[model samples]
Structure formats: structure tokens, C-alpha cells
Target: MSEKLGAERLMPNEWRDDLEALDLEIVRFAIICQVKLLEPGVIQRVLDNDARDCIHGNQTAFASLRGLLFLHFQMQKDLAEAYGPSDATEIVRRVWAHLQPRVGDQLGSLPNPGALSAV
Candidate 1:
């Protein structure tokens, strides 16, 4: 990844012109997983309160944004309080905790606890 920060991590097209909550969830998932699964834009924009633009004027998108923000802050506070000041290390652990590895991801890598490798 580039040495640049969050917004800098995104490709031009990765940014969502829309502020739908589901769309923003993609970004939140990226953050929690600690992997750049998407070319995510900056979290600052994702967290913007005034960015609510729901199609049909429904509140789902706005509600989703609120939930996402709550989750982000809660996780931040939880990790800090639980793990002390080891942000980097704790983040790695958090990523793995949330990881849903595909078979391809594990074919030759991580071993399953009780499963034998195919010969």
C-alpha cells in the first residue's frame, strides 16, 4: 500500500458518489478487516453527518450511517480499553477475528484445526 493515509489509499473510482449506508458499510468492513478490500475513500467523508442522500427520501441510508459511526467509535474505544495502547497489534488481531477466509485463501496457507491436508 502507499504510505499515504485513508483517502490516499483509494483509487479514483473507488469513491461512492452516493452516501447510501450499504455503500458505506463496504468501507466500514474494509476498516474493521484492516485490509484494503476496496479502494476505500477517506473515512472522514464516510463519517460526515450531513452527507445523507437517500434515494426516495427514505431514512435507511441515514440510519445506516449513524450505525456505522456508532460501531466505529465503539470498536475504537473497546480496543483501546481492552488492549491498552497496542493499537497496531490489536488491529491485526481484530482483522483476523473478523476475517472470513475463502477456500482459495486457505488452500496452501492457514491450517484448519481438525482437518487434514489433501495429499
Candidate 2:
């Protein structure tokens, strides 16, 4: 008799989709970060909260996160140039508020850190 493979053992395209989804999450987070940066008070609050601790400790992960941060900064700069710095922050904040929950859901679907570490 042949043994049956479980769903976990079966390869699925969901993994790739999940990764792509993660990229989108990072983009969304970056946008929020940009909005937060626009307000010195908000940026100070975020730094005081030590939110960086949530990021992965690995160098590659850090670099990837930094890249996303830079992307958001650039996006903010572009918007400011086009729409005026006075209103760019508000626009970013609104866009981020819409994107945040979707990103959170996608991130929540990913495997936990321990599972990734085991691999």
C-alpha cells in the first residue's frame, strides 16, 4: 500500500503568492512609516517606543527593511514635489490607513518566526 502525503507535504503555488503578498505588506508599512516621518511628533513617538526591535535581526533582513524605508522616503519626496509638501503628509496618512489592515492580514497569514527558523 502506498502512503498518502498530507497537504503540508504537497507543494502549492500559495507560497509564491504569499511571498508576493509579503512584499506588498512591506510596501504598505513603508508608506505608513513615511507618513509618520512627516510629523516630527509622530516620528519621535515611534523612536521612543523602540519599534525597531520587531524587525528581524539578520543582516539581510535589515538591509531589505532599509531598502523599503528608502523607497517610502523617495515616494514621499516625489509626492511633495508634485502636490506640495504641505499636503503630501496627509495624503500619505490616508493611503496608509487604507493599506494597513490589508497588510496586517497578509503578514498574519505567514508562518511564525520559529517555523522559518526551523527550516
Candidate 3:
């Protein structure tokens, strides 16, 4: 059998760390969107404005916007797959219920260790 298929080929620590960081950032973004500090649609408006500019903006700007949208949709897919489909309100409730204890006083929470397996 190939070494790549062997148990020793488990993911490297750096990749694991990167995944953890991404998960934390995703959760933080979600929390920020929930807080009332920003008016509703403010985020969407910002993204839309950037997107408009990207039409004539440099490649880096377009790539940045594309990356952001990819991450956004990826989070949505992960949430649905992890918690199942439901109203947005119910999904938010489930997300917090899963996260609150794990995060406690922290600004944001990482997924429960090993929760990434499903993701």
C-alpha cells in the first residue's frame, strides 16, 4: 500500500492549525453579524460595494471578493450539514447551543475537537 494511504500519513500539524484558525474566524464572523452594533444589511452593503468595484478593480481585489464569497457559502454548507436544515432562527439557536459552552467567556469558540471530521 502507498505511504499516503497509511496511518502515518495523517494530516500535518500545520494544516490542522490552519483549519482551526479558519474555524475560529468563521465563528467570529458569525458572532459579529449577530451583534446589533452594526445595522442589519450593513455587511451585505459593504460586500456589494466591493463587488461593484471589483468589476473594474484589480485582480487582487476580485480574488479577495471571490475568496470571501467562497468562505461564506462554505460556512452555510457546513452549518446545514452539521446541524441540519431549518429556519435561519433555529439554525442560529443550534449554533450557539453548540458553541456557548465551548466558548464561554472567550470572544469566539472553536468547533468541538474532532467536530471537523464531519466538516
Point to the candidate with the largest TM-score.
2
Poorest 10 consecutive residues by lDDT, candidate 3: 33-42
The stretch of ten residues in a row with the least summed lDDT in candidate 1 is 110-119
lDDT-sorted candidate list, best first: 2, 3, 1
TM-scores for all candidates: the values are 0.35, 0.42, 0.30
RMSD of each: 16.7, 16.8, 10.3
What tens-digit string does per-residue lDDT give for candidate 2 at 13-116?
33233333444655555344433222223333333443453343344444455565444455555545655665555555455445556655433332322221
Error (Å) of candidate 3 at residue 18 is: 15
State residue 50's C-alpha deviation in candidate 1, in Å. 3.9
Candidate 3 lDDT for residue 22: 53
> Model 1: per-residue lDDT, tens digit, 1-119?
43855433443223222212332464444334332222222234335543322223334544465466556455444434544436523443334334434222321233332111010
| Candidate topping lDDT | 2
lDDT of 2 at 87: 55
For candidate 3, the per-residue lDDT at 71 reads 62
Q: Candidate 2: lDDT of 118?
A: 18
